[model samples]
Target: MADRAGSGTPISFRGIEKRFGGVSALSPVTLDIEPGEFLTLLGPSGSGKTTLLNIVAGLVEPSAGQLWFGEQEVTDLPARERGVGMVFQNYALMPHLSVFENIAFPLRVRKISRADIAVRVKEVLQLVGMLSLADRRPRQLSGGQQQRVSIARCLVYKPSIVLMDEPLGALDKKLRMQLQLEIKRLHEQLGFTALYVTHDQDEAMSMSDRICLMDGGRTVQISEPTELYFRPQSSFAAGFLGEANLFEATLVQQNGHAFLEGAGGLRLGPAPEGARPGSRRTALLRPENVRVLATDESAENEAIGQVSEVAFFGGDTRLTVTLPSGMSLVIRGSTGHGLVKSGRGETLRIGWCDSAVTALPEQSA
Candidate 1:
């Protein structure tokens, strides 16, 4: 692949805010997207993920604060003048144009010579593994094929930054996974700064170098996927990233180790930092990190619960255990882990390592 002239550029949002009538679509947010990094904006609907992406694309201007592309200020720049590439969910390819023409559109619009446009378009098609489909129109290709063309078009211009708004939203699961690998490869190969937006936690976790988790138009947490999943700082962050077994408890400290104590002698700990000793807290236990213990075994973090339900999902089994306090616990383990030994209505002891519990701040009322 040919190297782009200005391949990678950093983007910065300095205290950006957006509002419409009496509603605040986005609160003040300050973030920096590093050069050549794939940063994902992840959150649920109405969480302002799309709004932040649009602000970077120059589609929606911030009501307050400045936007910067590298050292240059682009707060007032128009969408076309910002020199950014955009890939959308619907694969916004021209239905009447063939693959080659669709990829060549941007170069032609810039009035590049006929021969140069042809060369650039062919190169991008080959980069995306779609050169063989050059003659096919959008209507003639499958959903995946059209998306490949859409990506090829975005790459043909070789813009320094690419804004993707759920580009894989329309594809089936198999195709989505396949394209995810391709996109990761292309980003690594070409080194374009990318800001991708999606509501799918799995997609964000798999593709992002760092995830910027958002909620209700505010930034919840921004960190690598592992940290976000294992060390969430808030209740919303704990629940949004993946399946977490959350328990309400009061924070307490004995000697040096912190603990969370709930009703029925349920205690879990080595709580995370910044937790006040007497404050209320929520203990986050990841299903995969939880262990189903034997009757005679014991640990610092243990609970007695009756089996409620069991689900087998190919390589793993999901067990639902109801505690004496009527709390439902979700535990994920390998199918061969002997979880079924204690059938439904049977009592079992479940435990986790003290280090596995992530104590987070309780939700505010």
Candidate 2:
């Protein structure tokens, strides 16, 4: 299991904050990334994702807080001395150097002998499946192949921690997905500690052991992929990690269960335990969890809506259903399994069980 704690000391951030000019890029943040675990920093642009990663990599100095790598405090350490590997969005391979030389550069800089460098570079090239391209220059390789060389270079140094900043952002969708699986496999094989930064929700969810979700310069949530998807702690986290239908509601009663009332007489059942009653809240429901029921099927929560729009993706069909209350919800169903034809003004019943809904304390929308 990804959550299985290791015996080694974990990375800890204590009240980490960074400021630029008058703007605070990252507010007070604290977290512990387990040793030998794959952790991803996920957020929108300017949300301080890269800033936080840079801080971990010693590329940027934090205005406040301390950073620790295992039991050592590295808040003041320089980049070169941090023993961290970094793969950037741009494959930073030297144009004049072949793949073998590129992977050997770090060892050479550290004063390793030519014989040792060759052995290390060969091992990493084979690890990344780029052994055959060892003599090729950056210009001689495809985007994916170049990335492999870059990754090989990073790993050749055997850094304790690897930090990747949008390393796949420049690749096309198909190639990106391919590399995503490759990286996941590599992580499982090596068990090196990694802190990945990306804006793509699917990419993060697919590869990371846990996702650290950030927004507006603050850490919003830290959870395993499935937990983050199914039980987000905040409305921002719920909406950002994946698609969700969020609605403002008021908690009406509390016993073993609670009820929520939304606009246009939309009444919903109790949220999961831990939600207090008599408070305004936000409900997040995933599209896949919202079912399109047959006319006679009884549902825990039901809404009458008309199909306002439909989109056919290869594997799934996305439907935009406008409820009678004038709220529109996006629902996803298997392409071959959903209703064959749905158009504007077509009536449908949409519902979800009590398990699908989550309530969060009301925050600024």
TM-scores, all models, native as reference: 0.93, 0.93
lDDT of each: 0.87, 0.86
lDDT, candidate 1, 1-365, per-residue tens? 12333368999999999997779999999999888888999999999999999998888988998899999999999988988999999999998899999999999898999999988888898899999999989999999999999999998989889999999999999999999999989988888999999999999999888899999899999998888888888888889999988887887888777778876758876655777788877788899987888767878788889889988877788899999888899999888887645578878888988888877755630
lDDT of 2 by residue, 1-365 (tens): 36544332367999999999999999998999888888999999999999999999899999999999988999999988898889999999999999999999999999999899989988988889998888888999999999999898888878778899999999999999999998888777776788999999999999988999998999988999998888788877888888889888877764545688777868765754565566777888788887788767878999989998988887888899998788989888787766546677789888888878877655632
- Model 2 TM: 0.93
Candidate 1 overall lDDT versus native: 0.87
Error of 1 at 160 (Å): 0.7
Candidate 1 matches the true fold with a TM-score of 0.93
Rate residue 167 of model 1 by lDDT: 98
RMSD (CA, Å), each prediction? 3.1, 2.3
Q: List the residue pairs that clash in candidate 1.
A: none
Runs in model 1 deviating more than 4 A are: 1-6, 253-258, 272-277, 295-297, 340-342, 362-365
